[model samples]
Target: MIGSEKLVARGLGRSYGDAAVVRHGRTVLTERLDRFLQFDARTGVLECEAGVTINALIDHFLPLGFFPSVVPGTKHVTLGGAIAADVHGKNHHVAGAFSRHVRSFRLLTASGAELECSRANNADLFWATIGGMGLTGIITDVRLTLSPVPSPYVSVRYERASNIDDALELFHADDHRYAFSVAWIDCLSRGGSLGRAVLMRGDFAPNELLTARQRHDGSRRSPTPRLSVPGSAPQFVLATPLMRAFNAGYYHSHPGAPRTKVLSYEPFFFPLDKIRNWNRLYGRRGFLQYQCVLPSVGGREGLIRILEMISSSGSASFLAVLKRFGEGEPGQLLSFPRVGYTLALDLPNRGPEVFELLERLDALVVRFGGRVYLAKDARMRPETFRAMYPEFRTWLAIKNEVDPDWRFSSDLAVRLRLMD
Candidate 1:
């Protein structure tokens, strides 16, 4: 069902936008090539086909004590997709991006020649491919470092923050106590409550930390999703009033008394994963997931302005997440994480109004030295993209040098003018 002049490799199509779609062109579905090539239990290293999904990893290897060191909100993503997007999770402030754990990968270039890429061999290609979003080349296989966990349980702490300031303070003052941390914010709240959020932090719970029943239970393997949305939800179900109510319910549900509890890993990391086809809840128009990072210098102020703008505009996102990102390889050229705050918002496709609000948000992002995550972007202007990611020039030079004719291109690349 896919064929064209310029091609882009697609894995699972969970990128939320045109990154994986080729429009009228050919989109080579890489999922069929999924396979596990090698595994080393002692070293906690895994080498597998690029098409392998995070869900596949946990299902097959989590029981064996190995897990991907980095993951996104959902596990329905492929290893190649994770590396391409340079996905980050609650552990970003600690583990950095997904590329940090990737040992090496095999790249199939536009010239039909295969190259072994890593920090050592074809190093430039390796960095470019890390977060290149399939614009660099087609990654066929990857070798990644995995973390060894005692069990599939996590020790979690919940904190209630009055606003963005309190959340940031808690993150800075308490994040060192855990391995993973994130916040679910209410974008519909204005005034002093502009950033009211629930700060959730966690670390893999040790065997000794788990209760005997929870520990000795033989069904300790990954649990399958028990619920699904079934079909698209009516657009009216997510209007501002309903979303505000939902956000209110979520905020109140967690009194967040700085409590710590042991829970299974599935819900701790991938809560939305329990519900299949959950995206359909946004309705037939779908939703735009806007994710951007603000540098440490003006991050807080920039973030506040953003939240305030969204709240005042009456364009509330159903899911708003905030997190801190630590340092990353500055020389990598294309990765998204910086040492600062990052926010992700999911807004319903309410037509022109949504785009207008996003444009206003873009101005703030550009002024604050922020860049949108290409993996989640659906409607970003070329100028805005360039302003946000000046490193694109560096990555572009590498892409031109490798794929001069521009054989590797996607709808996203065309929209952002990455090839022009």
Candidate 2:
């Protein structure tokens, strides 16, 4: 804050896009600030530095029956990073986005003055920070409201949907009853099976419902240690034919499968966590994740167009997930949730051709009044961002009031004109 006039405060750099990178200026890496400040176990409220990761929190608190109220697919993200992105999870259809569970946090403004912000005090800053993508100010520490779980295991059920319509029907039917739900969509599928998906639904399991093995494993902890990928898998490994085959096997393996025996929270809620440096699998080229949420109206059409774009382009995505999102907090202007369906795609950086194909998908998202998630974006154009996120301008107005000099900036901010 003192030495650098321009700085981008970043946590674990888990954002798939340039949202966490400083384009030309220096970056104030916040990972070192990690420290567990305080905790109220009974109330499931805890205070910690912005740099404290979700994995760290789980390792320390899960045994006590408290966990993040809403978590994304991975646990490597930090508290500050989560707030910046306003991350959401499979349970978003019921619990809303992560910002709803954040109690308050300490904000370090451009002038290096600290302000305590929340719904009641400095409400603008609170809302701006929730989904403001860290452009408003620098987050230092946060007090989070956690959820109480019966145990560290989940009662899961799997069902395969024949097509996109069936998948939507299944999600709408069961979303109300389950705390968490998501589906793995087969992007490579074509013809009558376009948008075919494997649906997964689950909720925290009560201790009494845990299996003997799970109970013996103390609520089902991970047996294998997390390991980092040394490098990207050979490009040939993800060829369209191979991916199609993998998807076919996966879909056939779980068609109408009965309820699963108990699954641990780590594997269920954070499967990627088991592989420490999974990102490296994308290779030195770095991959991009395109996540977009389309409102219910025209959602099916928009999704179909997106898939069609990918299909015609022959750009195969190895991992794709689709889920429903509920309403979000008031102040979280940039929060990526609404009454709609959200889809996330993992694209390994094959080259310019792949990026060009994504641009077509972006056009389709914008046409349908859907917006791409800033957390996972890497190549979205500034014009497209403005058109998709109508709140972008409003958030910028608030950001200007705090960091008028553009002290807090990132490659994302620069690209999207968050600060000009």
- Candidate models: Cα lDDT each: 0.88, 0.83
> Residue pairs in steric clash, candidate 1?
3-26, 4-26
Q: Please give, for residues 170-246, the per-residue lDDT of candidate 2 as tens digits.
A: 98886789898999998888878889998888899988997787787764434565476767677776677877898
TM-score of each: 0.97, 0.95
lDDT for model 1, on a 0 to 1 scale? 0.88
Error of 1 at 380 (Å): 0.2
Report the lDDT tens digits of candidate 1 across residue range 1-420: 122268789999989889987766677789867899999999989999999999999888888887899989999999999989999998988898999999999999888888999999999899999889998778999999999987888888888898899999999997877899999999998888789999989899888888989877624666677899989998788888888888888898887577888998888889899998888888898888889899999899999999989998767766889999989975577788888999999988899999999999999999999988889988999999999988888898899999898888899998988877
**Predicted candidate 1: what Cα RMSD to the true structure?**
1.9
TM-score winner among the candidates? 1
